[model samples]
Target: MQTSPENDLVTIEEAAAMLGTTTVNILMNLKRNLLQGQEIDGHWHVSKASLAAHGGDTKAAVSKPLCQRSTCGSCGQH
Candidate 1:
């Protein structure tokens, strides 16, 4: 829950708590590019704007992949 004095950016753990989600979920958003992130000193950095835009510290909504013919769990296309 450490804050960066340079930009006042909060850590992922803090963002998760503020957003009511797990850190892993936050990382997922970052990985999928659903949420904007910056790498500082080899670490991922999130901006307050990104968090606020996502509902004041909430998990960013990600598009779930549509079940394709090759991997439709329900239809067993595979």
Candidate 2:
């Protein structure tokens, strides 16, 4: 796809750093469609535009635990 300097693809790590968050959080955002990105050969590439948009949604880079937000099935305690 066509990419500009401001909209170039960034690795999950780089995206996380840019957002001051974690790679796992970025991956979860990707999975939940909370962020925009694509998987290439099993590696995730994030869109800079998407990252910029998400910036307003967060005040800080704190990561939330799954069970803290809603009923989580992963741990089976919720």
Candidate 3:
């Protein structure tokens, strides 16, 4: 992936494009508290770090486990 300076504050639309997702999806993530953001100028803003850490999907970072599950639903096999 190309590295470019990101806007200090990015809107849902811009984030969605950068993350290769839909605005609705991004919005949902924000609503579910899956993504880290702040309300500035009456708009939500996401950090570049948050996006990069989650592979553009912050929810996946927290909700999904590192390993595939065969026994334990949250992570690896028992």
TM-score of every candidate: 0.61, 0.65, 0.55
Tens-place lDDT digits, model 3, residues 1-78: 332234555777777777776776666667666676777767767766667778645455544542333543434344
Candidate 3 — which pairs collide? none
Specify the highest-TM-score model's number.
2
Instruction: Give me the displacement of residue 7 in model 2, in angstroms.
Output: 5.9
Tens-place lDDT digits, model 2, residues 1-78: 344334568888887777777798788878877678887777888888777875554415224444455664533566
lDDT of 1 by residue, 1-78 (tens): 577554746677766777776777667667756566676676666666767776632433322322233553423454
Find the number of clashing residue pairs for candidate 3: 0
Model 1 scores worst on lDDT over the 10 consecutive residues at 60-69
Runs off by more than 4 Å, candidate 1: 56-78
Residue-level error in angstroms, candidate 3, position 58: 8.2
- The CA lDDT at 47 in model 2 is 82
**Candidate No. with top lDDT:** 2
Model 2, position 75: C-alpha lDDT score: 39
